[model samples]
Target: MKSGWMRGIIILLVFVLGLSIGYFLPDRKEKMDVPVASVGDEIITELMWLNQLKEDYGEQVLQDMIDRKVVFSEANRLGITVSDKEIEQEIQKMRKAYENDEQFLNSLKEQSGTTLEQLKEDMRYYLTWEKLATKDVVVSDPEIEEYYNNNLYLFQEPEKVHAWQIVVSTEEEAKQVIRELEEGTDFSTLAKERSMDLLTANQGGDLGFISLNDSYFDPSFLEVAFSLKEGEISSPIPVEKGFVILKVTEKVKERIIPLDEVKDTIRKEIALSQVPSLPQVLDQLRKQAKAQILINDNGK
Candidate 1:
């Protein structure tokens, strides 16, 4: 299952208990009378909103929750557990996509609308589900080695440089920036203070690892960026956005990742491929558990 498929599931579970915050009130009349909106002459109460939510998302959300519960129950019965360390490792793997921990967290919030703890809980559920689903599946050593040999290109890392830049609207401005860097001024500080690239300026122009094949970067920028040695700063290079001076902080030569580093990942991939899809696994689990739905569409 995709890591973020549970993004909005938790909030949807709230509908199972009550729709609005006022549902927790001590007085029955107040709970029923809580207004959700004003329709000019009419007031829409919490009950109305609750009914609407139930009508729209209630059945699918309940089924999702049921699937989660079934997995957890089966895992508990079988003593299959996902540890905090395992979850952290998975999170670290996911974190590789971002520049830093802060960037990852920020992107997680922006893209998934979830906090770290919520993400952890989601991971726990997903990992537990995987363990339960794939417990019977086996991947042999030969299979892993064969898969690795067949997909060697997938393991190759391209030549990349961890670089920072200071973009200015004028060539003279860029030249002065370089002069400051040549003297004693800090590159990151100068970037924050003067760089015009709004996306990276606030982050001290951190262009975390760019490869020559990265199509998003301008050809002129890549030409200058890739040519510079580590710790060496480029002269003002003209681009669509006036001038950009790059400093390569770190460099990595192209190489294939070792099989040992990716063996467990390969094993998991092979095992998962052999097992039923996640939804199918959940459906089977529900059957084994003899799960029953107590609610119906008619609210009977």
Candidate 2:
């Protein structure tokens, strides 16, 4: 009986798979029809929308489609029309972000299955909706001041130590180096001659000003480094691979940066923090305008 039930479940699973396969299979005989949303005459097709979503955010493609539909509906109601110049600027920004890599450009083209022109058009629409949603938000001077006061620690620099390091692969070699250093041999010269970390060895193992918040070095080494004063050298600290000797070149005091220097940055951050409320504002604007979505094809 159990074997029979398992066979029945297997048959049902296969039938579902067959239906899914049939649904997705393209028809060569018929011309692909454009999907129309209920609100507008704009023709959005399944392939076109899916390709765009997959190109930009593969993980949240479905959520993106839903959000795009909502944005489009809201945009129409709000009379949020994006200008050609605005679209061009957005495309320019995106191009700059990916300019260093040819592979990224090629991958975008391949994933979208569209020309660069189409991609720019989509970005224009996206940015247009975004602009409409953000149109009414105003950050007052008081709000900025309050935010700065509340988060003063965020703008304050932490105490930091400027240090030089020497790493070697063996304890005996490290002891020998430490003996030479204690006898007044130059740390930088010894680092250049013996340190194993190639990236820093060339710079005489100078790690530069290491903030207390820096987690790259071993905690044991950091504890010792922070306790030392400027121009002081630490005893050889043992690690998994070998021993490390650190010299404190300088120390920096912690202090808050002035608000004038970071005013614009703080304002922008405050604006971005309020981004979640944009769609709500857009919805309010949408109630005053007219829009529609015609097709409801759930393309997987």
Candidate 3:
């Protein structure tokens, strides 16, 4: 049986080791540690598990640790350091991608099965790498403009429509509802009275916004929705669920994200692109530090 403490440590190790070779510190003294668990009458010891892991992943794990150490040392020698503020900014930046704090933490657990602090440590190492790699990289105004021009689509927003829908069971019913919508019957009132969509029936059949990019509705339906002017109602559109009648409430016109607005981001992107990849940087560090590996896989 595994001791709870050792089991907890192993759980941490599963993720901690995934992000790092930093678990077993190089300076920590090795020991012929005693049993940390027992299976029925037989014993399962710390040394046994350690040796097992070593046999399976010792070389790769050892290399990761060595590489981490070299990266840290090289960054230190070059006076490259990341601050607490920078780390927090990165953390918050990541959180923005998630809908809420719970989602953010849940995603962290699912992806790495690790705590926030451990993820931060991993991020700190990543930031350190970025600093070391792009420390001397420079991108000029011309470079930014050229890259922006080449990737113009990346900087443009697609046309989108904020619309509502009344989904009914049959095409004739859909057409009947459309006639009501046109002949002075309120769209929202009809939607609440007749729309079969329980989700949006109460909200006046609101399907929310549909864009060329959003896949919420059928692509053909979205095509018709975007084509209509705001307040215009569509004819019955056949779809997988049922026939849908859409009323455009808001049409956000497509616009080019101005050059000034995205120039800084473009600059950093091109600069990072110029920097060597993480593995290549680690390889360079290995040569610079004259790192060597001699792990014994025999579990001796």
Per-prediction TM-score, please?
0.85, 0.46, 0.54
lDDT of 1: 0.83
Candidate 2's TM-score reads 0.46
lDDT of 2 by residue, 1-300 (tens): 112222323333333344334446666112324463434756776445434443444434333344556667667777877777767655554553331234335645555444455565566555656666565678888999999999998898888888888999988888899899989999999999999976567778887777776777778888999999898888878987688888998898988988996786677678767776655755654455443334344433
Query: Mind giving the per-residue lDDT tens digits that candidate 3 earns over 132-237?
Result: 8788998899999999899999988877677888999899999899787778999989989998876678677766555676654567887898888888888889
- Name the regions of candidate 2 deviating beyond 4 angstroms: 1-138, 179-186, 275-300
Candidate that scores best on TM-score: 1
> How well does candidate 1 score on lDDT at residue 279?
79
Error of 3 at 226 (Å): 12
Give the candidate order by descending TM-score: 1, 3, 2
- For candidate 1, write residues 206-230 as lDDT tens digits: 8888888878788878888899999
lDDT of 3 at 24: 61
RMSD of 2: 14.9
How far residue 149's Cα lies from its native spot in candidate 2, in Å, is 1.2
Ranking by lDDT: 1, 3, 2
